[model samples]
Target: MSGFVLNERLEAESRLVCILGLCQLRLMNDSRWPWLLLVPRRAEAEEIYHLTPLDQTLLTFEAGETARALKRVTGCRKINVGALGNVVAQLHVHVIARNPGDAGWPGPVWGLGKAQPYDTNSADALIRAVVKEL
Candidate 1:
């Protein structure tokens, strides 16, 4: 893969965090969840199978690392990781830290309600925390 570009929807919805071994880590805009997206820098990779075997391993490693970092940073009781491409065809993994009684608790976060945008200071703090852990 080459000349990789982020999906328009992702670009609009996320803030760039940093680059991982096989992915570009991005922070989701929603304040309701401590969400991060791991988007592989592989052009046209709308699914995991599209990546090379070695790249696949790297993605998994990166996702696991991101998930752990999220958990540590947020101190959430649970961590949710998924790659559902129904709305956005681009292949990206979601690493979210969840706690009981959260807005979307005991259910999927998608479409449960509106996403509350983070305040400037909160967003910066979260981004910095995740980056430091990573």
Candidate 2:
């Protein structure tokens, strides 16, 4: 167990779908991809280096698990998992399922276009699907 919890802004900005074993699991607001965010429960952790070795291993495991689950559900041609704290400044990893012809293909999923928000039912359905796997 960790001493930290999910950030307020992150929870407010996205829909939480499932609980990954070692992290806070959230579904991104953007509907363009089957995207998930995994944030380790480390107090005030703003970078990967802030984590203890054991926590780092836990984050890696969570990220890999998220990537595998997303791949299995979405059948994406590729999956992107990374942690860049420039914007949110939190020690979090992103797991995105990407298709070859997605909104941003052969490139990063950041800042490509306006985010297409998922419909309420769609979001619920996706969340349930992910939860079933979790």
Candidate 3:
């Protein structure tokens, strides 16, 4: 996986948080929700089926761990986990922490509204909090 590279769109939208066993954890820049992306470090792998059995298992474990960390940090009402590759084909899972009255509640967050980029201080604090759990 030395040649693994994150897609440009993902790179632009997320900040590299830390590297886990089989995936690189990224913090989404949007501040509207506690969102994280776990992208497998497999070059040219667009879907989960493209990965080996071991890699597939690792992805699931990492995603679950990430979701737990988010839950601990945010205490969100719900945690949404999915691997929708409709736009960015990379094998990445979204672990979003959702609240009852948050924007786009009772619906998907995708395309609900403009993304509110996190300010520097808040983003740093959140990174520290999430890293502590990781």
Candidate 4:
């Protein structure tokens, strides 16, 4: 467990939020969407199946809670939850809040447009709101 460390790419792309039961919750820095990443703290876990059964169950619960919180905070038209580790390969689940007219509305947010990083004030506020829900 002590060997567990956040992937550097993930660390650069997101801000640390509070930890859930089995994952370290992170707020993606892009302002284009309200997104959260749930990363299990198990070391060398590059895939969902790498987790123990209990950890896998906890990850699912954490992902659901994150999706609900994002929906309540962003009031998005829909929520997108996925675990595509093709790029980062760090076993992270993405919970994205999507609106009908949002950029790449009908598609994935990846590579849609330049990421608009959140301002400190907005980031802090959002973190507070979501953490409160969690």
Candidate 5:
């Protein structure tokens, strides 16, 4: 399949880490939770159903693995996993660790506040930690 472009708005808003197999794994700019974004490398994929069955399976497995890694790293009580493209229109899944007293605690992380940008060193460290397991 021909590769489609990930929009600049999405890329600019997310803290992309390293590639995890078939997806370009990213950390959400929000520091509220240990949030992640998993985007397949396929182009023009505005919906998950647009992917081939093989790719769909790969994305699911990869998202789960990433979620587990995030849970382990954060020791979070809960993990919220979802794929919603209402705003950016990219086929990306969100894997977020939830805690009782987090910034968006007792509510969804979307539209509650601004994203906390990570420092280069911190972002690099997180990427290193996650990539080590992949």
Candidate 6:
């Protein structure tokens, strides 16, 4: 897409880790969970079906790869992958590493608790590690 600007809400919430074949790999600012977001660079794509056929498939591939990378980095027992655009309405996939005793526990991360913003040093280190994995 030519003018594929990131949604403002997402831009305000996350930092760019890298770009993938069909999505922009971003690190969610919250430190409580090792979370990543994959946003497809398609203009006005509010849903997965809004993307081109190739883009839809590419999004799945990129999201899965991101999840594996996140799991390796966090060593989490479970991975939560989803695309619930109820609020931001952007076509972004959430690749979150979950453990048994996390803040959200068995519930979804969204709206469970306040986000703990990552420290600058921690953010940089994680970004470097994730980029290397990608």
Where model 4 places Cα greater than 4 Å from the true spot, the runs are none
- What alpha-carbon RMSD in Å does predicted model 6 have with respect to the real structure? 0.9
lDDT of 2 by residue, 27-78 (tens): 9888988889887767889888888888888888778877887887888888
Give the poorly placed runs of model 1, Cα more than 4 Å off: none
Supply every candidate's count of residue pairs whose N, Cα or C atoms clash at under 3 angstroms.
Answer: 0, 0, 0, 0, 3, 0
Q: Write the per-residue lDDT of candidate 5 for residues 23-92, one digit (tens) a residue.
A: 8888777666778889899988878899889999999899889988888877889988887888888788
Ranking by lDDT: 3, 1, 4, 6, 5, 2
The Cα local distance difference test for each model comes to: 0.91, 0.80, 0.91, 0.90, 0.81, 0.90
In TM-score terms, candidate 1 sits at: 0.96
Q: What digit string (tens of lDDT, one per residue) describes model 6 on residues 1-134?
A: 78899999999999999988788999999999989999998888998999989998898889878888888888999999999999999788899999999997889999777899999999999989888787
How far off is residue 28 in model 2, in Å?
Answer: 0.5
Residue 4 of candidate 4: its Cα lDDT?
85
Cα-based TM-score, every candidate: 0.96, 0.90, 0.96, 0.96, 0.90, 0.96
Indicate the TM-score of model 2.
Answer: 0.90
Tens digits of per-residue lDDT for model 1, 38-95: 9999988988998999999999999999998998998999988899999999999999
**Model 5, residue 45: displacement in angstroms?**
1.6
Worst lDDT 10-window in candidate 4: 106-115
**What is candidate 6's local distance difference test score?**
0.90
Better-scoring candidate (TM-score), 2 or 4: 4
Model 2, position 98, has a per-residue lDDT of: 89
Cα deviation at 5, candidate 5, in Å, is: 1.4
